[model samples]
Target: MFLLSTILYDKNHVLQNNILTTLRHVLSNITMAKNEKHSVKLRIWFYSGENKVLGKGRIELLERIKETGSISSAAKGMKMSYRQAWQMVEEMNEFSKLPLVEKQLGGKSGGGTKVTEAGERAIIAFHTLENKVNAFTVKEAEKLKF
Candidate 1:
């Protein structure tokens, strides 16, 4: 009876060890799968004299302004304050050679804003450069070792 009990204990110990090894193997595979499927995001911003000229966030603001036709409306749509949106527009206008946005005075018809030709051009150029940089980064990521 004693020998039979010792044999049963050894079988149970081996079974537990096998189960633990299988669990470890599964967890490591899951971790490796996660590590293998990853992406790189590139945010490109241009600056001049310690001031930001153009960046992803600013570009989104510009697009929002163009879409909404009012800085306040754009701000509301983005869940930002009117003052913050106005400040960003001011900074962009100050930095650029041409004013990117033009505001009309409020009257019976109400005031509205529009993006200048230069603003449109700037948006296009920014997106073009951004796309190029993102493509380059993706290629670089593909070449990464370890």
Candidate 2:
């Protein structure tokens, strides 16, 4: 579980009398060590890079290409340019050190792309495990109030 910290203020029941009373209490307890309010929220983005991202988009593209008949068709279905999807595929292939897709050249059957065995492995690992991790993190976050 991740321990995230954030600044918090209690203004829900604020009133003039409450403010004065709080100030008096603080002044009376001046010698006591006060727990300072957090002044900033610290949020960590796990993947902060092109290569670092788990390439779920590339996985979906590969899956779609495998299901459909063409890379162009998959890109269109994903609402992405073929060139952009191709670039993402290249990046993921490099990041994973595995060729996640293969191409068949022109013929009467037509040229198209398919996910390799390694690609299938990657898609399963990414979607299943990453989803579990995210769900756990979300549940943990929901458990925290202040």
By TM-score, the best candidate is: 1
Q: After superposition, how far is residue 44 of candidate 1 from its true place, in Å?
A: 0.9
- Which residues of candidate 1, in runs, are more than 4 Å off? 1-36
**How much is the lDDT of residue 106 in candidate 2?**
92
Q: Write the per-residue lDDT of candidate 1 for residues 27-145, one digit (tens) a residue.
A: 88888866766888878886767788778878888899899898889889889888988898889888887788998879646997889999999999999999998999999998995
TM-scores, each model vs. reference = 0.71, 0.59
Candidate 2 residue lDDT tens string, 1-146: 01111112244544555666766777868955475543332222214354553455666787898898678889999999999877776666666666777877897568887888987887787777777777777777777758
- Model 1 residue 56 lDDT score: 83
C-alpha root-mean-square deviation, each candidate: 10.1, 13.7
